[model samples]
Target: MERRVGEQYRITSKEIDQYDDQGYLVLKNVLTEKELKSIDPIFDHFVAGNESEKMGKDFCDMSQPYGTPIEDFQLVNAMLPGKYIPSFSKNIFYRIAKNIADQLYSNGKAAMDYEQFLAKKPTKAEAEFSMHQDLGYWPKTKNTWTATFSLALSDADVINGCLYLIPGSNKETELRSHRPKEYGTATNEAVNRDDSHTLIIESKPNDKIIHLPVKRGDVTIHDERIVHGSGGNLSPDWRKTYIIAFRDERTIAEERAIGFTHSHNDEVDWNSIIK
Candidate 1:
């Protein structure tokens, strides 16, 4: 959780106020093209290994873990020591997590194991993700113990499945949606009725939006109840991102049920980022 120079990003008071009020924040240019360029190809190599000839498949099949092959395949589980560690992924976990811990929470450290580098591509039968909080999948809690850092690897647009969020929705009481009954589960979708509550974060390449589109290294520290979701990818290219989900010590057990653990003493492998 200690800060590192060249990796530390200071959150301003104004930005903090805005994030507290709006439920999200965007940090632009956190990752330069040089950084992204180095990592993208490595990730592409992983995706290529599991390339499925079945182009229209709903999700990555047994061939791919997340519709993209694994770059540092060994890093999938943090408990094991692995040889696959991409520089970008490693720097983000150590530097970004440390910066956030230094700037936001005192006496509390950010555990960055429950994170994933995600790649979402359009399929023949792609479905829109339902509006829900990031914490929707976890057990209920009264305290704020978790947040997410979503870094978009490509230009995310409505035409190609941009991420949509209910701004300030994080401030409201938590609401639960029924679990997807099964694969291709039916979702009771509804319109966003409150303008003040919802705000869509449509992003351009290298233009980061917190909780969604962050520069290669730009991280978003959000409240657990932030209302967030994404539209299906409409673009021909895939939407790639590295997500580092951070949590407090008390919440570690609950997170482990979902399969995330640290790599060392108070340290999570940078490659352990998951969905």
Candidate 2:
């Protein structure tokens, strides 16, 4: 299953149907050992160095208020690494991801919308991301077709903060009410502080939640409207994930016009906030 450069990862019709019905799908062994190894130094250089603080944000729980102490922050997220490390965008994983996305998209084409690194630190019980849909963080557009490909850089399991999503949640025509997780009032228009990046939708007690655990190099793809989140890394090991998202080029431009930007945008002065 070690695909070479330029080799496409074909998506079967059955896989596409499943994604349509369930809002998420997992593809195993999409990256070879060599490809995975090639990313090691990049992750190390950022995670183990002071530069990470300058380029990324550290937070505890998405539900917590902003300004949590740095040492108490259980998750470290660096967005758009390709901006600083050109090799990231040049990786074979991105090409294969685009290939797969092309097959899943109705238009038969996709563009690289954004990418990021999310690392759950070991033994951080409060590191969980609150339940939320990707669209919750974006502006409403006529064509909401987009896919996020999350590649596991470390073995992901329940103990180590694997993704959990609600089945068929993507079918909702209207966006659910979402507010910054720390907001005290129940208002759909609750604006998040400039420093806070998380918005959450409250899940009902009867929702069917599915947790997806994958081995290193496996990738999980999900729709933009899906209600999803991950748990804390209670294990003694890190749960590292590299996420790349694809969308129609037109949709990208439409969303940008409405002042919508990803939380980990390179344009932000993250160093001022994180430090």
Q: Highest TM-score: give the candidate number.
A: 2
Q: How accurate is candidate 1 locally (lDDT)?
A: 0.48
What would the per-residue lDDT of candidate 1 be over residues 1-275, giving only the tens digit for each residue? Answer: 22235666666777767666776667666666776676576556444543223222221321122323434221121211111333434554445555654565554666654544445545412434445565554444334556566666676656555566766766766354433212321563432211011222333254323335433445455556666666665566676655666667666765465453422222223223311
C-alpha lDDT of all candidate models, in order: 0.48, 0.76
Q: Model 1, stretches more than 4 Å misplaced?
A: 1-5, 49-89, 122-127, 181-221, 257-275
Q: Once all C-alphas are superposed, what RMSD does model 1 give against the true structure?
A: 10.4
Q: List the residue pairs that clash in candidate 1.
A: 47-69, 115-273, 115-274, 116-273, 116-274, 160-234, 160-235, 209-213
Estimate, for each residue in 1-63, the C-alpha lDDT of model 2 and write its tens digit.
333335588777899999988889999888888888988778756655445455544322343
Structural similarity to truth (TM-score) of each candidate = 0.63, 0.85
